[model samples]
Target: MNSLKGHPKGLYLIFATSTAERFSYYGMRAIFILFLTQALLFDKELATSIYGSYTGLVYLTPLIGGYIADKYWGIRRSIRWGAVMMGLGQFLLFLSASMLHTPGWAHGLMYGGLTLLILGNGCFKPTVSSLVGQLYTPGDKRIDSAYTIFYMGVNVGAFIAPLACGYFGETGNPDDFKWGFLLAAVVILLTIVIFETQKSKYLLSPDGKQLGVLPDARQQALSAEQAKSASAGEQSSRKWRNLGILAALALVFGTLFYLWLGNDWVSVGIFTACLVFPISILLDSSLTKIERERIFVIYIIAFFVIFFWAAYEQAGASLTLFAAEQTDRVIWGWEMPASWIQSFNPLFVVLLAYIMPAFWAFLNKRNREPSSPAKQAIGLLLLSLGYLFICFGVKDVQAGTKVNLMWLTGLYFIHTMGEIALSPIGLSMVNKLTPLRFASLMMGLWYLSMATANKFAGMLGGLYPEAGKEKILLGFRIETMYDFFMIFVIMSGIAALILFLLSKKLRQMMHGVE
Candidate 1:
């Protein structure tokens, strides 16, 4: 399992820290919906809406984190402080849960806890990613494989969190939601402490300056290999001209493409921001022609992946609640825990993650592997199919008796296959598309794709009726219980078709980067 080639032990250090971090984050998140709506008697739909906003903002604020990490605090300092903040936030959450009966004080602390988690996650998320990049050198192919390994660390935490936290929140003593919160807080605090004590053993002593803090002595010598650099004044002006051109494009979408007004606004905003760096290259940027083209191709693929995340992220806010209050959970003479259902996703991810790499190697040997876009398209199609499974399964279940756990379990398995196809590999594609100069910015934008997708997923979930349920789909009348799942299935299918049409163009732009 160990792939060794002078990879500093720090990679494993990061993997361990991430595992702990995921356990803490997911443990809390997986149970929060159930605790809020079921235990606290908040309306399910309102709790879902709020959850969506909370999760969306959690991701959206990273733009600020990236700016500060790049310009002021540096990655290590920002990351450490973020850990401290998140730890404190988790602890506050525990106190809030304790005071749930205290009315006003409870509400204040609840908001306060959420604010800290968002701010802390924003600071920690981007910098930790940047630190991973710092662990590698230019032209190192191992970066892709290393990230796959890191993502597994994420799944490991995701897989275990539900079981651990659900036990505290839902099982044994039912009023122990506070116990779960306390446990989650303690775990996060432990992660922060563990990470701090071994900083030197993990990351190279961060130079507290900029993105260039390579611990490897060889890296310092090779820093001269930078592809391009410009004065801040020149860079700023070039970005402006780039904005002017995109503004024209935006006007076209706003005025002429009226049928898709909402989409037009979003697509234009995305396309406009995307156009900036390449346009900067065309203007103040200094690079060989090959570099610009490569970056352009990467941008093309990035726009394509946004749809994938929009479909995949529905699992947390919407789907989790759907399973809880709607779906039948009766199995083996017991009602299944709603929070426990979420573990099925990462459970599938963990089981099948190792299979894909082997399958890819086999495909690579035979030249039978699908292209990146094709693989991603397949993922969407399968995810769509998974949703369809749940829709059909529960279309006839009794009002409160519960849907079988096996359906959720099976659907997660299919969705995990889709994730393996798209998500794990998408990161590698991003690094390939990004040129050295705009690397961090491009990565930041890449995450914005996820941020938008998560919010949209939340909104989609809200469309479901958590009360007075019934439904119609594909011109056939069905239970309202199954309608939202059907909609998601249809949406993912449409996304797949669109991506399929554009796959050739995306591949062409990739210029063999995949």
Candidate 2:
């Protein structure tokens, strides 16, 4: 079956699966920091560090998962097993929360749960997203629109999970946290059931074969041919040797950073890998001049994206803490759950996702559309503006005095607009620019930016000022909320300006893909 717009039924099936999975992931995230600080009694800095590590590892594993899916297990198997691991991970979290009175047991359980979630996310995230790209053919104009709708589905899950899970978990009782974790587990199980049952019936390629299955003999032969073509040069062997050396260097740097920096090892490792892997690829003698330039463009845009996401992802850490501690949550004589604020960005995404595609269509029809790199620059600008909004909004408010909830709400709205401008488009850009032979690998590399961003977000979140405490970062004093928010304003604003200046050149380097 096809929609009136001619998108296949498989799109909706994948949408449903992704929506439920996101619900599980985001629901857990909604309460994770609160659970740590309130239930386990961890400090704000420690909890945020752990939160960053967990989130960063979640993106990091996709590199491994995408490879396994492409080479051996296929998408369906990887997703299934991944779902199981995630379900178990959530269950462990529930158990951890349930044992909150036993601090030692709960702490052990919490680490165990986080490890599993990281492993599971590595398997599920990239493969499912790649599956969405598979649903559309090359040069399909609807691809962006399809991703927009798919992104809405993601927000639908994100929008609801916080409200539902937060209500259950944050009712002023430490023990209540288990309810949220349990809810996450149940939704993930539901996702697996829906995906396994319906995939055979509705999920199919454009040629009518079932989707997510392992490659057959003929497909394997073709992949081998493509690989051969990609490596057909005298320097192929040397490039492989260089890649190994880079990998070793990455590992060594990662270990040293871990030993020196405490909990930030994952971020350091991912940043190292992101830097090394691209240089190794650029050194590949088989790549054409065009391919090399395109790859360079990807790397350039990816670097700017790191700044964007580091600012944007504060929602899960510093922003969440801000809502809980500083922002006024009372409305019309009712005190709202702090986690309810988690719904705001997704709610805005749901509202704006519909508008953006149409807005872009209007622009494209008139030949007035900005290129992907240009739009991303706009996104970083909006993110900077969002933080600046908060900076000014809270400038008059004293510490320990709650401000209007609208301040946070307005910020999320602006941030969501920035997200719409950047996130979905980045996915489309990667799929369009990558060569077929390196598609899965390139997608993993794209996610590496996210991994670095998330860890960086955590590091920033760790800087959040505690009550009556002055925090200093990079020789600057963060003596007030205004100062904290101003950090992002300066960082994202500068990055956006630089990206805007480079957009024209990056667009040219894309070789007219758009």
Point to the candidate with the largest lDDT.
2
lDDT of 2 at 418: 95
Q: How many backbone clashes does candidate 2 have?
A: 0
TM-score for each prediction? 0.83, 0.94
Clashing pairs in 1: 328-402, 328-403, 470-480, 471-479, 471-480
* 234-338: candidate 1 lDDT, tens digit per residue: 668877877787667656644553454255343334333443433444443454566666666555555556666666776777678767766677776787777
**In model 1, what lDDT does residue 500 have?**
79
- What candidate 1 gets wrong by more than 4 Å, as runs, is 1-7, 172-175, 204-300, 328-331, 468-479
Give candidate 2 misplaced runs (Cα > 4 Å): 1-4, 215-236, 251-263, 280-286
Model 1 alpha-carbon miss at residue 169, Å = 1.9
RMSD of each: 5.1, 2.5
Task: Please write out the lDDT profile of model 2 over residues 1-514, one tens digit for every residue.
Answer: 5443678888898889989999999999999999999999999988988988888888888877877777777888888999999999999999999998789999999999999999898888877777777777788887887778888889999999999999999999999999999999999999999999998877677778777787222243444444666544645677678878887878777777777676655667777776776676676555678988888888899999999988898898888889999888888899999898999999999999989878988999999999999999999999999999888789968878888888898899999999999999988888788765455667777888888888888888888978766789889988788988999999999999999999999999999888
